[model samples]
Target: MQEYTQEQINQAESRGIEISTDVKEQLFEYANLIGEKEKVRALVRNLADAVSQADSEGVEDLLDDARMDIQELPDPTIGKLELRDYGYMEEDMVPLRKEAALDYHRMGSKIYRLGSAGSKGEYASKEMIQAHDGLFGMESQMWERIKDNNLDYAEENLGAFQEPMSVIEQEEALKLYDAGADIYLITNFSSPMYVTERMEIERGPEHYQMSMTELERFRNLEWEMQKYPQIQSLKEANLLLGTRRTFGIYQIRDD
Candidate 1:
C-alpha cells in the first residue's frame, strides 16, 4: 500500500479538512486492491508535472485522461481525493485565471491611456483611433468569454448544481446588475462571485467593498440556501444570464 506522508497529513490539517490516517490507509488499500494500470499511473504523473509547470494546455489534455481513469475505477474515492486534496483541480485553473486577470488589467490600462488623449475624433491619430477601437472590441469580447468559460469549466468538471435561491441573494444579484456589473457565480475559486464591471467605479471603493462583502455573505449562505426549494419555480426565475453546476449568473429583468 502507498504510505501517506506526514506532509499530506499536515496539508489536510492546514486546509481544516479532517483526512484521518485510517482514511488515507483505506484509500491506499483500495488503490492496491484495484491495481491501477501503468497507463493511468503514467498519465497521473504527467498531469502532476503539467500542473506544477502551470501549463494550462497540457493540464487540459491530461485532465480528460484523469477524469476517464477515475470514472473507470471501481471506486473513485482515491481519484477524487488526489484531484481535490493534492490541489490538481485548483492548480489547473491557475493559468487561465492569471491570463484573464492580465488581459483585464492590460486592456483596461490601454483603454485609459488612449482615452486620455484630447478627443478621439479631433486629437487622436488615425492609427490611435484604430488601436483604441481594436482594444475596445477585444475588451468587450473578453468579458463575455471569461464568464462563459468559467461557467462552462465548472459545469463540465463539477457537474450542474442549483441551490435554493433566497430573496436576499436575488436582491444582491440585482444590485450588482443595477450598477452595470455582470455577476459570474464561482464555486471552487477564491471568490464566490466575480464581477465583470470595470474596476474604476464612479461610486468609489467603499461601495465596491460593500458589494464584495455581500458576495462573501452570499457564499457563506450556500449550505443554508440548499435547504430552500431546489425547484426552478417561476417566481424564482429571473434573467438567468448563464449557469454551471450549483452556480449561475443572474440579472433582473425589465417588466
Candidate 2:
C-alpha cells in the first residue's frame, strides 16, 4: 500500500480534512506540551540554538516574566509566582473561600468563549464543526494533555492557556474531575475581560492609592509595548508550554 503523498495531503486539506497530523504533531512538539518525550525534546533541541542566541542577548528573563504575567495560569514545570490571589465577589458580597473563588474564576472564564459543539469553537467558526469530520485527533491530544495535567471535560482541540493556575493545581484539578465530576472550559487566550486580581495586602494601605495603571513597569508593558522584547524571552531555559487552554473542559452539560 502507498503512503499518503503530499498531493493527497493537499487535496485532503482543500476538501477540508482541516488538519495535517504533521502540523498538529509540530504544534504538539512546539508547545512542549504532550506526546512522546523524545519527540517533544527533539523539537525543543531543534530550536535550542535559536533559543540560546535569543537568550544570550540578555533579554531572557524579561520575556519569561512577560509570559508568566500574561498566561492566565501557571505550570508546575514553570515554578511559582511571587504573588497570586484568585478570588470571587458578588455585586456587593465579600470574597468567598479561595477554592470557591478559584472555581468561580475557572467557570466564569470558560463561559465566555464557548465554541458551540464539542469544543470546536476556538479553531474556527461554528460552521466548520458542522461541516467537517471530527476534530481529527486534535481534540484527543488536547484532552490527553489536560488529563495529564488533571483537567477535565474539554474535547480540547488545541490546548490550555493558563493565565493563573499552577501546573500542579491544574494536574490535581484534572485528576479530581476524572475521578467522576462534571467540568467546564475556560478560554484563557480570549476572554471577554481579564479579571484584575489585586494584591491589596502586598502593597499595604499606602499602596492602595495606586491603580494598575499607576504601576510604571506594568503600565508601560501593557499600554505602550504591544510586541516589546521585554516580553519575548525566558531565563530558566527549561521549557515553555504550548497553548494555555490545556486547562479547559466542557462548556455546558445536560442532565
Candidate 3:
C-alpha cells in the first residue's frame, strides 16, 4: 500500500472502491497469519524429506518431493466470506439475541481477514497455503476472545432472534401436536370443519415436536427467503429444522 501514492489512493477512493484503514490493518494481520500457515507447510515438507531419504524408491527428486508435499496439505478448517455474508452488520439481518450475535460477528470478522481459512484459493498452492494460515490465525484470535471473556460478553448480548425459525415460535397451534411449546401451528382452514383433517405431524424426523402447521409456515417462509441473492448458501437460510427433515417436507406442492 505504501508503494501507491496518496493521490492514487484518493483516486481509488473516488472511483467508489478503497480499503479502509481498518481493512489495511486487517490485511497486515492477514499477512502475518499467512506466514504461520507457511511454517506448518514447511514442517510437513521436512517430514516428507526425512521419509524420502530412508526409502530409495521414495521421492526420487528432492525438490519435487518438497513441492508436492506442500501442495497436498492436510485438510484444515478455513473460513470463506462472500461479499454479502453480513454476519456482523447492524441493521440488515434478523436479530440474533445480542450475546450470540456479537460473538458470531467478532469471530466472523477474524475469519474474514484471512480470506476465510484460506478458502479464497480453491487449488492448493504455496500462496494458497499461506492465505489459509492467515485466515486460521484470525479465527483463532476470535475464538480466543470468546474463551478470554469467560462468556461474560456472550451472555450480555443475546437477544430474541428475528429469523424465520424464531418467527415460527410465534405462530399458533390448532391441534394437540407433540411439538414443543415454541413451534406454532397454523392451518389454511377453508372452514372450521376442516380443522380435524389429517395433517402429517413433522417435528424433524426423530423429534416429533414441530407440528405440521408450524412446519408448513417455516417452509413457506424459507421459500420466500430464497428470493434473496445473498442467501445462496444453505448455511445462510434462516428457517432450519434443527435435526428435523428438510424444509420441503412440510409443504404440499401444488401441481
Candidate 4:
C-alpha cells in the first residue's frame, strides 16, 4: 500500500509542484495506516502459512489473532459513530438459515438414496430419517457459529473483492461441519462475506468514505498490493456491513 505514496510523489514531481509540509505530514500518516494494513495482511498470511504445518488448535489460535487484529484496527467503518448502532434483523438471517437447511436436507436425501440403492420401497428408512436429522443438526450448528461470532452473510456474490477460500480451508470447513463440531469452534470459514467484512473493517472508514470511482481505484490498488483481493467496491462492502439487510434482523451486537 505504500506504493500509493510513491505514486503520489511521482505525480507531484512530474507536475513540478513543490510538496507542502502539510502534504508531507498527511503522507506520513497515510504511510502509518499502510503499516497497520501490512500488519493485518502479515497476520493473515501467517494463518495461511500455519494451515499447512499446524495442528487444528494451532491454526485456530492464529485465526483468533487475525480476528483480534480486525477488532483492534484503527477507526473501523462498521463501528464508526452512528453506524455502530446498526445491525441485521431476524427476518434477514432467517431466510439464510432456512435456505441452508433446505440445501443440507437435499444433500442428505441424495446421500441416503446413493447409499441405499436396493431399497426402492416408498416407506422412509431409519437411515433416511437419521440423515435428515443429522443434516438439520449441522445446519443448526453452522447458524450458531455465525450468530455467536457476529459474522456477516454474503447473500449475493461478492465478486473479486472478497478473498478466495483455499482448498485446505474448504476441506476443514466441510470436515468440521460434518462432524457436528462445537458451534464455538466451527470457524464458519466458508462465508465469503466474513472475509469481506474483516478486510473492510481493517481498512476502516477511509474505505467507506470513498466515492464510487475512488473506491474502485482504491480497491484495485488494494488488490494489486495483495497477492490476491474485490469487484463491487464500496457499495457491496456496505451491503455486507448490514445496510442492505436492514429490512430484516435486529443488531447482533450485545448492548
Q: Compared with the true structure, what per-residue lDDT tens digits does model 4 show for residues 118-186? A: 122221233343443221122223444444644344455332333322222333333222322111111
Candidate 2: regions farther than 4 A off: 1-43, 51-55, 58-70, 74-255
User: What are the clash counts of all predictions, listed in order?
Assistant: 3, 29, 16, 9
**In candidate 3, what residue range of length 10 has the lowest lDDT sum?**
188-197
> Sorted by lDDT, highest first, which candidate order results?
1, 4, 3, 2
Residue 58 error, candidate 2, Å: 9.0
Steric clash count of candidate 1: 3
TM-score for all models, in order of appearance = 0.18, 0.17, 0.18, 0.17
Better of 2 and 3 by lDDT: 3
Deviation of model 4 at 106, angstroms: 40
Model 3 TM:
0.18
Residues 37-153, candidate 2: write the lDDT tens digits. 343334334333334454433333433443343342322121111111111111112212233223333433211112113232233222332344321112333323333544333
Give me the candidate number with maximum lDDT.
Answer: 1
lDDT of 3 by residue, 26-111 (tens): 33333222223444334334434444355424423533453453333211111112212323322111212223323333222212
Candidate 1: residue 227 Cα off by (Å): 70
**lDDT of the structure predicted as candidate 4:** 0.33
**What tens-digit string does per-residue lDDT give for candidate 1 at 15-48?**
4445435544533443443334454345435544
Report how far off residue 85 is in candidate 4 (Å): 34
Task: Give candidate 1's root-mean-square deviation (CA, Å).
Answer: 22.0
